[model samples]
Target: MFEPRLALASLSGEADAEWARAGADWAGAAVLGGVCLDRSTREAARAMVADRDRSEFLPDDPITFVDDQLAALSGVDLRPGINVRSTTAEPVREVAAVAADHDAFVEINAHCRQDELCAAGAGESLLREPERLEALVAAAATGADVSVKVRTELDGVDLVAVARRVEAAGADAMHVDAMDSEARVADVADATDLFLIANNGVRGRESVREYLEYGADAVSVGRPSDDPAVLDRVGDAVAEWFAEEQSPREVEP
Candidate 1:
C-alpha cells in the first residue's frame, strides 16, 4: 500500500521509469507497463500497433526490461510497480521474481480491453476465465506483492466476485477501472478487503472525493497523469481528504 493515497496508473507504451519519475512529486505510487510477458501477448501487442496504431511497450526481453525499469526507480521515493499481460503463469512468475528483487509489486493486467489482447487470452479475456486469472495472481504472489488491474461493468461478469477470488489467490491490491459504473467501487469494497485503487475519469476534487467516499483506498489519474496542473489538483485533494478522514469528530449534545 502507498501513502498520500494517490497513484499514477499505467499508460501502455508511455508508462516507463522516466514517465513515473516525472510524476513522482505528485503520486505516492507509479505503475508501469501493460508489458507483454510472453510470445503470444507480445504478438498481440504488435498486432495492436500494426493494425490499429496503438502504442505498446515491446521490449526485446521483457524480464530484463522490467528489471531495468524498477532499478531505475531505486532512488525514487514512490512505490514502483509493473502491470503485466501474459497468457500463462510461468512468465508472471518470472517477472514477479524481478519485482520482488526490486521491492516492487506485480499487477496482473485483466483490464486491457483491446481485441487483439483478448484474442490472445490475455487482458479483459481473463475476466471471463476466473480460474486462469486466479492462477496467475497466485503465481505472482509467490514472488512479490500482487495487484490485479480489473475492468468493471462487463456484461455478466461479477467484479465483486472477481475481487474475492483475487484476494483468495493472495493478491495484495485490486485496481478497479470502473468505466461508467463508479458505484461498483462500493460493491467491490463491500465484498473484499483488497486494497482498492479506483480509476477512470479522475480529474479533480469531486472525482477524487467520490471514489474515496465509495471506499477506494486510493485514486489514480490515468490519461492526464503527466499533466502537472491536474496532478497538483488531484494530489492536493487526496492529501486534504486523508487529513480530514483522520481528524476527530465531536459528538453533538
Candidate 2:
C-alpha cells in the first residue's frame, strides 16, 4: 500500500481556509484539521449524553468550516475529528455528511490526552472500552473513509485484538501513536493488516525511517510543523530516502 511521506499535524479549531491552504502548500499530503468535536467541557459532555445540540458548543464547527477550507486547500483533503469523549451516532453522522459534501475523509480521535476527555470517557480513555470503541468505529465508517487515530495501550490491553476489531469494522486505516519506542511500534504492526501510520515524538527523517523499518506504513511528525526549518529538514530527509529507495541497484558483473 502507498503510505504518506508527510501528513500535516492536526490543527484543532484551526480549520480555516488559510490554514488549509498553508498546510496543502507546505505538506503536500493529507491534512487532519485540528479537532472539530468538543466533549472536553463539562456542559458539552452532559449535552452529548442527553442528545442535545452540541453544534454551538465548540468554538466553531470544524466539520462545516472544513468544507470551505478544503475548497481553498486543493491538494490536501479534510480529516474531520470525532473525539471519543462526546461523539455519538448523531453528530458523527453530521461529521460524515460534511466529509462527504467536501469529498474528505473521517478520522476518529482516540489519542488526545486532554484531562476532560479522560474524566468523561473519551480520547485514550476509550481505548479501555473495546465495545464502545467498536461502536464509534462503526459510526465513523458511515463517511467516505474512516480512519482511527489511537495511542498504544501497553498496560494490559491487547493491541492485536483492538487492531482486528478496527479492521473488521472496515476502517480505511489505523494511526497508531507509537510514542518514542521502536520496539512498541513493531509489536503494534505485528497485530494487523490495516495500513499503519505511526505518531508521537517523531522529529527527523532518520526517526521516520526507523518507524517504517519497524513496519509502519506512514509516520506522522507534529513538532516540525511549528518550525519551517525543521519541516524543511524532515521534508528533505523523506525526499532523500524515497530517492534512494527508487534508485537502481548496481548489477554484479
Candidate 3:
C-alpha cells in the first residue's frame, strides 16, 4: 500500500523515471508506462503512434526498458510500479519478475481505450474479457504486488463485479479511473477489500476530498502529474485529510 496515499498515474510515453521522480516529493508511488509488453501489442502500439501521432513508449526491448526504468528510480524513495499492456499472461509474468527484483508493483492496463490497442486485444478491451484479465492479474501477482487499472462507466460492464474478480485473482490494488461517475469509487470499495486508487479530474483538495469521502483509499493525478502546483495542492490535501482522520477527537461530556 502507498503511504501518503497519492499516486502518479501513467501517461503513455511521458511517464518515465525522470517524470515520476519529479513528483516524488508529493506522490507516494508512480505507475509508469502503458508499455507494450508483447509482439502483437508492441506492433499495435507502433501503429497507434503512427496513426494517432501520439507519444508512446516503444522500446526495442520492453522488458529491458522496464528493468532500466525501475533501476533509474533506485535512489528515489517512492514506490515504483509499471503499467503494462499485453495480449497474453506470459509477458506479465516476465515483467512481474523484473518488478519483484526492484521491489516494485505490476499494474495491468485495462483502462486504456486506444483503438489500436483495443484492436490488438489490449487495453480497455480486457474489461469485456474478464477471464483473460483475471489471468493476467494472477500472472503478475505470481511475482509481485499487482494492480489492475480500470475505467468506469463503460457500457454493460459492472465495475464492482470486476473488482471482485480482480481481488480473487490476487490483485493488491484497484486503480479506478472513475470517469464521470465518482460514486463508483464507493460502490467498488463496498464490494471489495482491494486498495482503491481513484483517478480522473483530480486537480486539488476538492477533487481529492471527494474521492476519499466516496471511500477511495488514494487518488492519482494523471495528465497534470508533473505540475508542481497541482502536486503541492493535492499532496497537502491528502496529508491534511489523513491527519484529521488519525487525530483524537474531543468529547463533550
Candidate 4:
C-alpha cells in the first residue's frame, strides 16, 4: 500500500536519532525500533540496545522514552514514510493507535530472535502460533497502516499461510525477512497481494531488482545500511528502476 521502493527494516535500538539524520535522506522509508510492547520486553529492548558493560544504566520514563524515541527520529527532514516496530503480548490496537497519533506506520515484530523475547512469547515466538499473531493484527484499532515483519524460514511454520492470514486480518504490508530463504519471496508474493517488503542480505541495486523481479514490491536493507555508500547504491538502484519503468519499451524495427 506504500510506495517505499526501498525500506529500512527495523534495526532495534541501533536506530537512534543520529542514525536517523544520516540515513533518512536516502531510503524510501525509515523503520524505527523493535521497541518492545510491555515492561518485561522493554527491559529486553534496552538490554539489546546497550553494550554488555552498560546494560543496567537506563533511568528514564519508559513510555515517553520509547514513543518519543521514534517520534524524535521522525523529525528527519527527508524520510518520506516512517514506521515503528513493536513486540506485543495481546491486543495491539493501542500500539497501532500510538503510531496513528504519530503519523507513522505500525509493524508487528515476528522476526527478532532473542532468547528473552521467545521466552516471553514475543518476537519469533509468534511465528510458532499463527492464530495469536493473526488476532493481534486483527485487533489493531487505528487508521495507521499495519505491517507484519516475518522471518519466513522459521521451522515448521508455513510462511504462505501466515501471509494469507495477515492479509485476511487486513494488514497493509508483509515485511518478509527471508533470511536464506530468499527464493521464498515468490511464494510469499504469490500468497498475498499486500505490499511485500523483502528483507535480509540486500547488498546492491541488482539484489534490489532481483527481489522485485521475484514479486516483492520493496527491498529492505539491514546491516549494510550502516554504511552510507551502501545506502547510496540502494537509492541509485531505485532511481534507475523507476527510470526503466517509465521509459518507453523498444520496438523491433
- Residue 219 in model 2: shift from native, Å? 1.7
- The C-alpha stretches of model 1 lying farther than 4 A from their native spots are none
Question: Ten-residue segment with the worst summed lDDT in candidate 2?
Answer: 77-86
TM-scores, one per candidate: 0.98, 0.79, 0.99, 0.85
Clashing residue pairs in candidate 1 are none
Which lDDT value does model 2 have at 240?
Answer: 71
**Candidate 4, residue 119: lDDT:** 71
How far residue 235's Cα lies from its native spot in candidate 4, in Å, is 1.2
120-140: candidate 1 lDDT, tens digit per residue: 999998999999999999999
For model 1, where is the 10-residue window of minimal lDDT? 153-162
> Which runs in model 2 stand beyond 4 Å of their true positions?
1-4, 14-17, 33-57, 60-63, 74-85, 248-253
lDDT of 2: 0.61
Report the C-alpha lDDT of model 2 over 84-127, residue by residue, as the tens digit.
23445556656667766656666777676655456666666667
Residue 50 lDDT, candidate 2, scale 0-100? 55
* lDDT tens per residue, model 3, 1-253: 8888999999999999999999999999999998999998999888988998999999999999999999999989899999999999898999999999999999999989988889899899999998989999999999999999999979999888889998999999999999889999999999999999999999999999999999999999999998999999999999989999999998999
Clashes of 3: 0
